[model samples]
Every structure is written in structure tokens, then in C-alpha cells.
Target: MVNVFEQEDIMNTLKHMHKWFNDGLINPDAATTDQGPKWCVVSSGQGFPGAEVSWATGRGKDVYAEPFAGPLYSTTSILGSVNAISASSKYKTEALKYLEFVNTDETMRNMFAYGIEGTDFSKNEDGTITRTENCYSPATYSQATYFTLYPVAPNAADQWDKVEEWNETAESSVLLGFNFDRTNVETEIANCSLIMSRYDKELYTGTRDPEEAVPALYEELEKAGLETIREEYQKQIDEWLASK
Candidate 1:
């Protein structure tokens, strides 16, 4: 909740980025060009271990991924994929039961995730799955527990076990499960977002000097009521801590 945008460490990092950009170490079109596996020599994104297999296979090139830092478990990560029942739903109980069934029943979970078993995919004798042509491949993680879904070939059968171990060892954030309600600061949040959109991309991508750009951005955010938003966040966080 603290406004760390103007902190020394952040400023230093931006300064380094600016230097890199000027020295031609960073892509010249970094601020404007679209970047992805197919577009850039290097790109950053979130993915679990062993995800490179799929990325490599899809791109027909060797793709490797390494974590820059250890995993940190936080509210954002925990809720990255979630199922929510509508507050005004008439069948809230049935919805809850259905969600429970999806998470608990392997057959139901796989069907919901990968489609009809024989038609979409076939189970291997060694326990992996082979997806057929025109297979229904939705975002599997969002559907149910990853452990319940059978592993596709080239990905280890114990990949989910490794993920579980990774989760177990992840450092838990103090703010885990602390939801920040932005209802009171909606106007300020909107205004600040607009202000940030004008300057953040250029500054972060090293298209602008942080020394001059950061101050300008900060001033505009303050004018857009950034302090009010910060204060509201701090208040909620403090109350949440007290409850804990």
C-alpha cells in the first residue's frame, strides 16, 4: 500500500534501465513493439516449471525458462484462478455443490477441463494423456485442481507434485488473503490509473529518463488524488492486520 514508486531502489532500477536503453542494450522498440515468444529474443512472463516443453513444441524452437526469484505466495497468486458464485444467484447452493464436485471428482474435473475423454484425449498406459486433433483445450488451471488433470506427454506425470512442493515451499506474504476494497477510492483509483497510463509505460520501458519522468508522474498522480487512494489502502490493511 505504501507508495514505493519514488523509493530509491525503484528509482535506481529505472536509472539502470534508462542507461541500458541508451547504450543499445535494450530493444529500441521496447516501448512500442509487441513482445512475445515469437516476436522477441527474450521475454518475461509467469509460468510454472516444465512449461517450456509446451512453449518449445508450439514454437518449434528450443525455449528455456528459469525463475529470477523464488516463488512468493500472496493473495494475488492464490486468487489468480478462482471460481465465484454470483451473490444474487438463485441456485447458490447448487453452484457451490457443482464447484465442490468439480474439485473433488477427477472424472468430472477432467471432462470440464479437457472435454469428453475418448473424443478429445486418450489415456496412456504409463498414465500420461495424448490429446487428439481438434481437442478442447481450455485454460486448465482455471477450471479445477491441477493435480486432478492428467499430464500431457512430454510433461512429467509428477509435474503437479512438483508444483505442490513448490507451493509448499513458497514464502507466504503477510498480506495474503487480505482483499483491498476500493469502493471508497473508486474515483481516485480511476483518475490515478489514467495518470499512470500516460507516463508509466514510457518510464518503465526506459523510453524516458526516470529522474525527470518520475517526478512528473508523481506530481500528476498526486494531483489525481493518489494520496487519498494510498491512505485508504493503508487504513484497510491496518484494519485487516488488527483482525488477524
Candidate 2:
């Protein structure tokens, strides 16, 4: 399956994904997964499961496939901001024209999959659209809801054109929001987070001693940047709680 996480949210999403796959899909012995031959078309993420330590060398076969998804700072690839503060306003219409193109007034479909026109989906002879995927429905379900920060490319296989009339044109909620600062504790958090990582894998795989390992982990985190991170987080939480 294609990646569901988008930009700035890949790291956290990968943690959940790792847990989901480890339950049954990954071959713990092989340190790999079971999605064989399934091409992983990743978008805007990084450090996918099993990439750092598994099936990379030796004669071992990959139990699953994973693609890298990062450096994805923008969808600026296909569209340009019509209201860009350029040195001159000469190209204003040119930018707007490009937006119009991707908006489906020009291209019938988006780079993301819209659907396979007829076999698996179609515009019902009744002026409505329909899809016949084995057990999923974009009309009622989607992969993007989980990671609201980014949306996966639409399925190109569908060949469905963009519904220009329905695109929710709006400003992004976080467009001008301030990002939380944690550089002061980044180093500590990284080291302590590593301990937590090991703890998670060990707890799930039932290798490390849970009682001993977990407590030891907290002790280590206490020494790591965790306390500082906690304080920072607490400050934010306190502010939000007070406001509420």
C-alpha cells in the first residue's frame, strides 16, 4: 500500500505503522516485512520501517518493499502561487493560469489517481460517479484523514478528472502559525527517544525484560533531554489548559 503519512508528520506516523506491521506482517526473524513485490510509492516521509537494518546486505531477500518519502516541502511542483510577491507584477496572470491548469479547467485529472475510468470506476449513467474497488470507497473513505498535514497523491490509475466545482479553495490553517521550538533539547530528546525506540521494539517483540527494561528506560530518559522536553511541553499544555 502507498504511504499514508505526509510532510512533517512521517516520523510519528512511521511509529504507528511499524507497530501495525510488526503484529503479523513483519518477519521478526528476518527483520523485514511481508508486502512483497508491492511497490511502495512513498510521499514526503523518511526512515521507513526495516530500511536502516534489514535486508540491505547479504543474500537475504526483502520481506517487504518500502520507499523513501521526504524533502517534500511543497506541492510547488505542479502549481505556483498566483499572489507571489514578485519584483514585478508582469507575470501575475501567468501564475493564475497555471493554477487554473492544475485546477482541472485544463488537465482533466490530477497527478494523484482519480480512478480507472471504466473498469473499476465510472460516472454512472445517472450523472453520479462510482467506484468498484474491492472493498474501499473514496466517496466514503480516504487515506488522507489520518495525516491531515499531507494528502497522498490521488490514484492515477482511476483516470478520474478533478471536480473543479468542488475543490475546497481555502487558506491553510497553519499558514502563519508559529512552530514550537525545541532545538534547546533536540540532542537530549534524540538520545532519549532512541531509548524509547528500543524499549518499544523490545516490549512488542518480547525480547527485553519489560519490568527491568522499562524502568531503566525511564531512568535513562530522566537523564536524557526528556525532562527538558517535558518542561517545554508542560508550558504549552499549561497555557492551553488555562485558556480552555
Candidate 3:
């Protein structure tokens, strides 16, 4: 609910990542070595309804991209939505339909729930589109807009069914059920997020000089939850993975 990334540096960094995405730099198959700030690019559609609509409505573009830095942490209310549905015994039938509604609704698209219609677009004489927004995405700390977006499959553009398919992949990917008991390190986790907010973009976007930037992040991250958080997360993840 509270936007922790309301800082100026972060916004600019997101815009910078946009430049690379439009250039076609991000690829999923790229080796891990190629996945960072180098030539790497992060790409996603929209997380917020307002933004998702905006991103998809351009005239003729097949795909558009947005950059990221943070994984865009989710509020418990948001992530726990599926859990509540499951508990209520409606997750299988009702919740899935709702997700479908989110993906294929024209009313939702016109509303720009996806993102603001980028600046370069206009209706054409043939009723097609004439858009020129050239935006790119960065591979670091980008968010799908707001965490509340839950558009279903068909809500995507007529030409972009693959995007919806990809969503299924994301939804079905590993790490579905597991809980984080951060009581021992809640402060550290919050603090690390707070501290990382300061340098996430500047360092990754090349504006802050990575060498100087990373060290500062480390010092603060330690106070926030560096070792403890990682240890705890890893410990939990290991147990969860083993159970699976």
C-alpha cells in the first residue's frame, strides 16, 4: 500500500532501463553471467491496472517493455489472496475465472490498468494504430506496476496471447506455497529493503558507479538484515525445496 519506491533516482533508473528494452536486449535463455547490469534487460507487462491499459493500447506494437530493480515486494494481503481463496474452497473455479477476466477485458484495457498509454500513439484511418512510443526495460528492480493487478489471461491485447501464456508460466512456476516467519529478522528485512531502495537504481543503472555504490549498499544492508536475512531465507527455501 505504501509505495517505498517513490524516490526520484529510482524513477529515472526505471526510465533508463526502458531504453535498453526497446533495443531488444533482454533474453531469458541468456546465461546467468549475462543477467546483471551489463547488457542485461528486465522485461514485464504491467502490474497496476492503470499502467497495464496504457502499455497495451498503442496502435501496432507487438510488445512493450518496462524495466525493474526491486522484485517489487508484495503486501501480505496481496500475496495471501490466493491463500484466502484456497481456504474458502473457491480457488479452483472462481478465482481462476477472475484471473481470466483480468487478462481479456476490453473495459479494463481502455481503463489503462496496465500502464499509461505511452506518449506515441494515435488512432489510424484504417482503424488500426499508429504508435511510436519507443520505451525499453531494465533488468533490475522493475515492478509490473502496482501489486494489485490481477488481470486474467484474455485481458491482454488480441495479438499478444503469448503474454498471457507467459503469465501462466509465471503463475505455475516453482515456489507456490511456503511461509516466511521473519519474526526473528523482520526489522532487518524491512531495513534492508529501505537501505537497498537508496542505491538500487543508481548502482544498476550506471549512474552511481557500481564500485562505490555496492560497498555502500553492503554496509547498510548489514545493519538492515544482510547476513541474517539471507541465512533465514536460504534456510527456509532449502527446507521448502527439500519438501517439494
Which structure among the candidates has the greatest TM-score? 1
Instruction: Write candidate 1's Cα lDDT for 130-223 as tens digits.
Output: 8999899898877778878788887888877878888788898988889989999999999999988888778887889988988888999899
* Clash count list over all predictions: 0, 8, 42
The Cα local distance difference test for each model comes to: 0.84, 0.43, 0.48
TM-score of 2: 0.38
lDDT of 3 by residue, 124-214 (tens): 4433334444623232122222223333232433323444443434433244566778888888878887887777655444444444555
Error of 3 at 83 (Å): 9.5
Residue 73 miss distance in model 3 (angstroms): 16
Q: What C-alpha root-mean-square deviation, in Å, does candidate 3 show against the real structure?
A: 13.6
Candidate 2 per-residue C-alpha lDDT over 1-244 given as tens digits, one digit per residue, 9 for 90 to 100: 1112223454344444456445755445422333443332222333323332323322243334454433222334213322343668688778667545544431133122344555545554433444455622343122111111112222222222221211233234321222456767778778976877766654444344444555676677778866778787667656655665
Candidate 3: residue 141 lDDT (0-100): 20
After superposing candidate 2 on the true structure, give the runs of residues whose Cα lies further than 4 Å from its correct spot.
Answer: 1-93, 104-107, 110-178, 237-244
TM-score per candidate, chains pooled: 0.83, 0.38, 0.41
Which sections of candidate 1 miss by over 4 Å? 25-27, 32-38
Winner by TM-score between candidate 3 and candidate 2: 3
